[model samples]
Every structure is written in structure tokens, then in C-alpha cells.
Target chain A: GAGVSQTPSNKVTEKGKYVELRCDPISGHTALYWYRQSLGQGPEFLIYFQGTGAADDSGLPNDRFFAVRPEGSVSTLKIQRTERGDSAVYLCASSDGQRETQYFGPGTRLLVL
Target chain B: AQSVTQLDSHVSVSEGTPVLLRCNYSSSYSPSLFWYVQHPNKGLQLLLKYTSAATLVKGINGFEAEFKKSETSFHLTKPSAHMSDAAEYFCVVSLRSNDYKLSFGAGTTVTVRA
Candidate 1:
């Protein structure tokens, strides 16, 4: 069985640019989550999806950060007008459903210069 | 508000010695507590979790944590330390409201010495 997989393990972009990170959750997992971790800090929640619709987007810092799971299996986290402060590791995780244990992916390290 | 706190930012122990990582949490409702480990250049892996069903919970790699409601703590412990146990550990909490969102603590970096 394969675990959650994330593409573009690392990304470097200039400020004001845009980037997209992808995540493929485990099969049959209906709940997906995204988080960000800064250097020397724990991960902070960003957004979550239950099936094709977003269940929570309160954690998104602003309009620049948006995520989608249109097909209910794969997800994409899009960031626009990236800032230096946006530099961090973006993590993705999935669970069977709400209240179930979530498994994590390797994450994509984003650097905005 | 719900929050988690890791009392120690770092813990060092000799191989074969006991290991302890302190964590405290505050939540209005019965929360689900979890311990996750992340080695260098890797993602997080669940060591163990306590969902209010049992006070004491056992996890992988010989790690364990006890949820103490009186003191609002869920500290991780291991009888023996292994070289591979050196990594960053995070304590997380989710309220009983059925929200899958987790609130994470700063994290504790464990170092193992031979």
C-alpha cells in the first residue's frame, strides 16, 4: 500500500510569483489536510478537505493561499504573490474521515526569495 | 482556546538510558492527544495517540504517553533510548468537537549519545 505522496519536493521562487503544490492522499481516504512548518517550529494547520469540498479554510493566512480537491482524491495548494515569509515546508496529510488518525506525506519545501 | 505546549525544547540522553519528553495541553472539551516524530529530512509519523478512551496509551517504537486530566498533561516516555530515536517530536491536540484539525506545540528535539 502506498502512503500519501507529494510532488516537487522542493521549490524556489521569487517574491510576487505563484506556485502550486500537489498532494495525492492514500486510497479511500476522504479527509485531506494541509499544513505549514517554519524553521524550528511545529506545523500549523492551513486547510482541510472532506471529499471534493473544503471542510475548513480558517487556517489559510489570506487570499494568497488557496487549496482545492476537486476530484476528491488529489489536491493542489496554490499560492499567489508569494512573500519571503511564505518560505516554509508545506505538508499534506490524509485520514479515513473526520476524527480518524491522519497520515502525513513527505511535504514540499518552498522558498521565496 | 485549545493549545498544546512542549515544556522542553530539547532532551538529551545516552543510548540505553530512559527518555522523557514533556508536553502539556489545555482544551475546553475532551481532546485527542497525539505524539508525532520527524526525523531529519522526513515527514511526521505518529508515535501514539490518546483519545480519552484510556489514560495510558502505547505507541510504536516502544514509546508511550499518559493522559492526566487532573494536570492537563500528556507526557511521552520510553524505558530505553535508541540511537534512531533522535528526532524532533511534536505534541498535538484536537478537541472532542469532532474537528480533525490539530493544534501543535513548538516541538522537542531529542538527541541521543553513545
Candidate 2:
């Protein structure tokens, strides 16, 4: 079975620039989630989608972070006015809306210079 | 409020030796627990999960974990460590009964030596 996949495995940008990270969930998965992992730390939840709508985005650090999962199946995480603190690995995960277990993607490592 | 804690930040064991990674969780209600592994640059992989069904859960690559409610602990163990087991392991907890949000521990780094 195909697993979750993320695009632009690595991204480099300057401060104040915008970046978009994409995620492709497994076939038939209705639950999707995005998380950020900083150096020497564990992953922190960013946002989650049940179908086409975000069910939770409370974990977003600020208003600069936004994510959308339009039409379901795929999602994009957008970061506006990126700062050096935004540098980290953006991970995506998907589930079948049951069991509470999630399969993760390789993640996109973003570096804000 | 719910949180997860990995007792050890790092553990080193010789190949073919036993391995132990301790985890303790705090939750207001019964929680779903999971163990995930990340090997170097690889993505996170599910090792096992305990969703109130069983106290002892078995997972891939001969890994297992025991859920102890009395201790609020879910410790992962392996009979024999493999070089492939050298990776970062995370213990995650889902506090809500039906929520997609997960809270992860600081993670334990395992190093396998031959």
C-alpha cells in the first residue's frame, strides 16, 4: 500500500518569504495531520483535517501558519513571513479515521535563512 | 491536560542485547498510546499501539510494549537489539476520546553497537 508522501523534501528560503509544503495522503484516508519537528525535539501538532475542513488548528504558533486540505486527499501547509524560528521538518500523516494510528510522510525540511 | 515523558533521552546497547525504553504518560482520561520510530533521515514509523484492547502490544521487527495503568507507563522493549534499531523513538498520547490531535514525548535516541 502506498504511504503518505510529501513534496520538496528540502526547502531553503529567506526571512519574510513564503513557503508552501505539500502532502499526499494514502488512498481512502479521510484524516490528515501536519506537524513540525525542531532540532533535538519531538514533533508538535500544527493542524488536522477530517475531510476537506480543518478540525483543529490550535497548535499553529501564530496567524502566520495556515493549512488547507481542499477536496480532500491532498493538503498544503502555508507559512507567511517566515522567520528563522520557522526552520524545522514539516511532517504530514494520514489515517483511516479509525484506530487513532497515523502513517507519516518523509517530511519537508524547511530552512529559513 | 495530558503529556508524555521519555525517561531516558538516550540509550546504548550492544547488538543482540536486550533493549528497554521507558515512557510515562499523564492524562485526564483513558488515552491511546503509540510507539513510533525514526531512523536517521527516514520518516516516523509506527512500532505499535495500545488502544485499551490489550495491555501487551507487539509490533514490527520483534518490538513490543507493555501498558501499565498503575504506573501510567508504556515501556517499549526488545528481546534483542539490532543495528537497525538504532534510531529515535517517540511515545505519543492521544488524550481526547475521539480527536486526531496527538501529543508526543521528547523522544529517546537508541544506539546499537556491535
Q: What is the DockQ of each candidate?
A: 0.82, 0.73
Candidate 1, backbone clash total: 0
iRMSD (Å) of candidate 1?
Answer: 0.9
Docking level of model 2: medium
**Per-residue error (Å), model 2, residue A109:** 0.4
C-alpha lDDT values of all predictions? 0.95, 0.93
| Tens-place lDDT digits, model 2, residues B1-114 | 789999999999999999999999999998989999998778899999888898999999999999999999999999999999999999999966655787899999999999
Residue A112 in model 1: shift from native, Å?
Answer: 0.3
Candidate 2 Cα outliers beyond 4 Å, as residue runs: none
C-alpha DockQ for predicted model 1: 0.82
lDDT at position B62, candidate 2: 97
Which 10-residue span in candidate 1 chain A carries the lowest summed lDDT?
A: A97-106
The second chain of candidate 1 has a TM-score of 0.97
Cα error, candidate 1, residue B30 (Å): 1.0
| TM-score of each model's chain B | 0.97, 0.97
Clashes of 2: 0
- Per-residue lDDT of model 1, residues A1-113, tens digit only: 99999989999999999999999999999999999999989999999999999989999999999999999999999999999999999999999999888999999999999
